[model samples]
Target chain A: MTERVYAGRPRPGNNFELYSWFFMRISGLLLILLVIGHMVIMHIINNVDVIDYDFVAARWASIGWRAYDWLLLFLALLHGANGVRVVIDDYVRRKGWKVFTVAVLYTFTFILLILGSLVIITFEPIGMGS
Target chain B: MYRGGEGQLSFILHRITGVGILVFLFGHVADTFLVGFGPDLYNHAMAIYRLPVIRVLEVLLAAAVLYHALNGLRIIIIDFWPAASRYQRAMFYAVGVVFLALFIPAAITMIRPLFH
Candidate 1:
């Protein structure tokens, strides 16, 4: 027998909740590092004039930057989407609405993430095919 | 409708900021494409960004990017890592500490050069 002191029903497992909470802080710290690295290389290195289409082409030519950007894009979307999911749970009282909205949100988030990653990793910066 | 102390406020603010960043991202891409228009047009457009007002705006933009990105990381920490949830409040303050430590110095160094 368990003493029920709380008003609302308790969340089952709370696995998602636990992970979501941890993700925000960790990702935020990492974003600071990522953004600083990006800005230093892109902006402060040789001034903005050096960055042309050729510069972009040369940079993305490397797998290192591709992965860096991939990490950034996915982390950003997931972080933002999880925040949105929490908002839906907090405000949308109807159970059906909550499920529907979260599903749509996640779908969009993942689709964008996948598409962006593909473009970053496989992009041929010049007009011609590689 | 959100009350103080509720995590909901943070979520709402974050969504707004995220949307803002998305818009900013699109505008940035479009501006990059504008560079392809022509050298003269690109130079003129780039020149507009060098004005005093634009410089001020850039500073604000930098702060916005930093704040959103940093606070966002905080939200993630609280969401996924239950083991650290106990220290959420302390962790939030730690973010502020980190922000100030970097921001203050960066601002001073950035401005001093402009003045001298």
Candidate 2:
């Protein structure tokens, strides 16, 4: 905690933390909605087996499903990745460890996000019947 | 014996769980990508997930998933915001309490579904 003088100038430091602080709140609120909605749709919907290649093929055929899945994918990856980023920011004390861990996390996060989205958008069902 | 284990323990556990979740995510990606190759591979891959031991593992994975998600949200607030540091202790307890509250119900729902 910093002390404020009689003057109006408040404080000076990196605003990166400030933005990340706000990101957590906003993303947390959104994650609650997104994750719950995703769970209900995918998990609790009668039969889990109904969600196959054909099911996904039908769903993503619609722009609505595409948009919904895209948002869910984007939000979840950002939310989880940023979450990991914060953990690294806090615990990885050594400079080398900090850089190494964050870099590794960021690399994997990007790979997962890209792969997940690509699969969701481009699924095909014709091969399933074969 | 676990006295005053919340602060540093929370920090250490969060890192461990985050890495664990990423590992799970990679496995999930690999399994999901198998669907693209063909249905036989996809079905076979999924059947592997249907064993009793795998079911138990899935339950643990779900627990780990929720724990990492909720706790990460809590730490993000305290670390990134100076304002949150004031109520950090309170918020830490709040996070644990709320995580248990939600997680217990979810666990019960999951477990009960199996028995029924």
Candidate 3:
């Protein structure tokens, strides 16, 4: 048995939650295609042993690969980070703990996104010492 | 806190797989970032992934991704089409069937290199 209690608070007009929900569905659909393609190419089409420096170099040498990887990195990270935030909100009751947890998650996500982008965009095959 | 049901199980699995994929993403990004350090470091890191245990983990990852993606589609459909909500349980089972169908072949392919 649940009792309804009235909390005196003004309702917000923003549809942030609605948009976030939509983003999850759309990004998830895209991720399925991107991640499957990535796995198939990296693991199935070619085995792990073959993915040495030269293979990565050649793959990243192309602009297409760079774009594909960059999109995959950004969407996957954002989607996962947002999902984690939802989990944190669900489980964390304390205001301070919730803020701190979300802060750490966002910070790490930011750094990883930048790092991943830089690596994919600036990767040079020739730089690898023979 | 929902009790036992297909809906509850689907919800729980979606959360678990989402977190699982996130963990894998962290390791993956770290390993790929090694490329900036040079080929030796990058290749060395990749070599470590070929171990039997790691290969098994890869299979698990594949399973997670498959379930998440399939269940995600179901979620999207239910969200946009209210009428489909009645078939949510059936859709969950369909996701499981599709996941296993795809995952078993993927797992076999993943481990084939190890034996050869």
Candidate 4:
């Protein structure tokens, strides 16, 4: 009984929490590759200095890079959001505060997903047209 | 199992690094979104990243990422094979060694531009 002191009240649901746990592990594995590949390509091989407008334009010109980046953005945001949800559940015991914090987390995640997908999907290479 | 050991240290660091990466991810997405506004606006923003101080922070970010990813792997191993829980302390150190191996080279590359 004492061991469960820190565990948050388990809300009865359709295995939502179970799914969240599973998602973190799976997404973490995928991100290990996606993110490291991204870092190696952008930061090591090329360096930040070369990553400017034209560089982005050229890279996004390829559908493959666009798809890869879109997947990274999607997975990273959802994985991070769920991870924070667990943190909030653990620390924010106050009901109102927890609600507000989770609300903010969800709202931020939703807005960013939309904004990021828009940028990736609607991108037009410079010099092609306005 | 005890709170006064590597398990606790890994847990704390995991939470810290996860939150830190989330904050950075938010900023990264917002900044990347600026590419839609045009090159002048985007490159103007990229100027901030070229600062020497930001270069150092980039190295720290790399360290945080490597630590979090490696430690998360440790957690997954223990979860899937509970029998391996007995060796988690050793796994924690292993995670550290691998983190340093990968991070040192990446850190050097990340910060080398600052020296040049």
Best by lDDT: 4
Scored against the true structure, residue A5 in model 3 reaches a CA lDDT of 17
Candidate 3: residue B43 Cα off by (Å): 1.0
Model no. 2, DockQ:
0.22
Share of true Cα-Cα contacts across chains kept by each model: 0.08, 0.13, 0.45, 0.53
Better of 2 and 4 by lDDT: 4
Per-residue lDDT tens digits for candidate 2, residues B26-52, read 677667766666667777787766555
When 1 and 4 are scored with DockQ, the better candidate is 4
iRMSD values, candidates in order:
7.0, 8.0, 6.6, 3.9
Give the per-residue lDDT of model 4 (tens digit) for A7-112.
1122235689878877888999999999999989989999889999899999998999999999999999999999999999889999999999999999999999
Query: What's the DockQ for every one of the candidates?
Result: 0.20, 0.22, 0.44, 0.52
The model with the greater lDDT, 1 or 4, is 4
Model no. 3, DockQ: 0.44
Q: How does residue B38 of candidate 1 score in lDDT?
A: 45
- Candidate 4 structure quality by residue, lDDT tens digits, B14-60: 99999999989999999999999988899999999998889888888
Clashing pairs for predicted structure model 2, backbone only: none
Q: What C-alpha root-mean-square deviation, in Å, does candidate 4 show against the real structure?
A: 3.3
Ranking by lDDT: 4, 3, 2, 1
Better of 1 and 4 by TM-score: 4
Query: Could you give candidate 2's per-residue lDDT for residues A20-107 as a string of tens digits?
Result: 6566567766765676676557654522445555665667678887787778677767766776777677678999999999898888
The best candidate in terms of TM-score = 4
Report chain B TM per candidate: 0.77, 0.83, 0.94, 0.97
In model 4, what are the clashing residue pairs, if there are any? none
Candidate 2 local lDDT, residue A8: 8
> What is the Å distance of residue B14 in model 1 from its true position?
5.6
